[model samples]
Target: MNRSSFRSVLYLAAILPFFFSDCKKSSSGPASGSGGNGYYTRFKMNGSSVEYDSQPFAGITLLKSDSLYTCVMVAYKDVNAGLKNAVTIIIYSANPIAANVGYNDPLKSRRSNGIMVPQTTIFWYDSTGTGYLTAGEFADNTGNTGIAGVIANAKLTITEMTSASVKGTFSGTVYRSDLARSAAITDGEFYLKRSQ
Candidate 1:
């Protein structure tokens, strides 16, 4: 597999187990507008609103390795039938993240504490079985060109972080595997608990 494909597989491998665990939905009512009711993940993709209610399976996770800290946040929903949609964001930093901060340039790596931290990445898996990546890279398929994809702009900010939950917002443009199409995600907001 190509590097991008391999990375995609690795990411899926890391998170699938958490998703499969038993989960329960929150008892709160549905969300309204951008903020209300209870914890929620909502965004507009291509001007279409998509929201995922609070569930134990969708939340944030923190991992540590030597000096690198990785924070992963996931928002997932089973829209209908067997169709599933999900959005995941992965952030890498040199130190433990404990406050409000913005990851503006997800395509640019930064050096910290003598270590090279990788750029943040976002992934979208639509209910239609299509995938989009902010990095603009994917496995080879029919009519696919082996070129790095372009990301016009992407930003994810951690607006609030507490021992109980993490609140954030994100906006970005992501490209399909073959670069044939792009999706704009806006007005993204998520309030998720820390995954145990």
Candidate 2:
């Protein structure tokens, strides 16, 4: 495997255990809009809307292993006072992802950027207190407590992007491996500076 493939595998290895483990929901603070920083991402977690911006959003990072591999990362933390809950989104692609194009399968894994799957898997790190990462799927969580595929029908839409910055909107259903529960995440948008 190449460097990108190696990194991807490493990440998968690190988070696999969390998929089978049980998840303890952490308390979250008030969701706020952009704090003067033109970036904010909001989504409904089990029907409740949560927002994160530059102030509590922490930072965003972009990484590339080669021409065929790219990763976009966003982090959020410290919302409520003394609250340890945090969230992260890692978007990985094989080809050079451009704006306006809908990348499907936001929950399935591909061997490489050129290779396409029915779904694209996005890494989700829920570091509320007991930090855990999972290759969650994009699927609806209505009455089910455990997810079959983790996530389904995951789609990411990029509204703006550049070497120095990336802006986009993403919406999907997320599934948890620890349990059969899922969350309907919609109207999720973000604008972030590219970090080296």
Candidate 3:
């Protein structure tokens, strides 16, 4: 990730939730979308699920249900210790139903009313020529609560296959409840590259 890109991630870690949530309407105005009578109306997504070399990446997913639009993102690093390979999907719409969509929702974890899981996975790279990182499973919860964790199998898979010119580096600060943990993604990226 370039310095600008890292900055962008840090920015998203702060305000992207608006883009991910029902905070704004899909059209016609700024933050004017409505989640009318329904069981949908979710909150936010993390990655864009873009396809480059026949693969998905660390991205935010946009999911719209009976009445809402939600976003989901999955990313993690820390490969060697096998301790930070976790995925957190957060969902929160301005609607009551959307309130159910979140990672690690104590009330909704085992219930079916909160998360909408389809078929998807995402991969992200710490930097160009640094190796690739992947996340699995899906975790959901509301922002008010703690984000849950997905049981993922992560690894660093980059070895003399691509040109460094096209690959990139990653940087960004995280917004954790505890500011001390603000370097979440950075820690992940560094670990991914070092392990391989």
Candidate 4:
């Protein structure tokens, strides 16, 4: 074959593999997260809400891919409603804001210390409108627990989602416990990125 024809054929051979490879990747679901360093967050129970020494801690984690993410901020309360101190797991979904994305943990309330009181649930929301939480409670405390006015469930409101403009407050009435009485969680922000 002529030199020009030979070179043209060679170029096509090299380009075919790349085109097919890209097509295969794009057809699949969204690319995975960046598995980057997880986010940090904290909170305290208010009024009549006593927190245990362990269990129901809040934090974030990076997934494998390098794009998505997951996180949780649990406030565990240990109360003796009856025979068992019900265990509560309050879950939150990290939403994306200002280019930031939201993520949820794969596991919830996995413990061994045994729940002391009926688990109460709460969901936190922000102005970002990027994510929301699914809340549920375990009220096996017997005697209707007589309504403790506990944090039960809290809604987080913010004027803006940006770090500089992010300003809000956390208010609630915890039934009874060894925790602080009414606290304002105004620190600790979770930062996420694609997992490389």
Best by lDDT: 1
What is the clash tally of candidate 3?
Answer: 30
lDDT of 4 by residue, 1-196 (tens): 2334323432332232232221122323323211122321234433223322212233234323322232223321221111122112232332322222211222123223442321222232222211121211222223222224322333333222433222222332322122223233222232211111
Error of 2 at 82 (Å): 11
Off by over 4 Å in 2: 1-35, 54-67, 79-84, 106-119, 123-127, 130-151
Q: Output the worst ten-in-a-row residue range by lDDT, candidate 4.
A: 75-84
Candidate 4 or 3, higher TM-score: 4
Error of 4 at 31 (Å): 46
Most accurate candidate by TM-score: 1
Candidate 2, residues 1-196: lDDT per residue as tens digits? 1334434543563453233222222444334333466655566655677665523221222234333334444434433322233345555455566678676553333543444333334433354333233333323222221434443555677778777667777666653433344456667666665553
Write down the lDDT of every candidate, Cα atoms only: 0.58, 0.46, 0.25, 0.26
Task: Name the TM-score of candidate 2.
Answer: 0.57
Encode model 1's per-residue lDDT on 1-196: one tens digit a residue.
Answer: 2546635654573465355434444334442121243666789999999886535123333443334566677656642212247666666665566556766552333344443333356667777756675642232212133454544456788888877778888887776655677798899888876655
Give lDDT for model 4: 0.26
lDDT, candidate 1, equals 0.58
Off by over 4 Å in 4: 1-91, 94-151, 163-165, 175-196
- Model 4 scores a TM of 0.23
| Ranking of all candidate structures by their lDDT, best first | 1, 2, 4, 3
Error of 2 at 180 (Å): 3.2
Over all chains combined, what TM-score does candidate 1 have? 0.68
| CA error at residue 68 for candidate 2, angstroms | 3.2
Provide C-alpha RMSD values for all models, in order.
6.4, 9.3, 19.5, 23.6
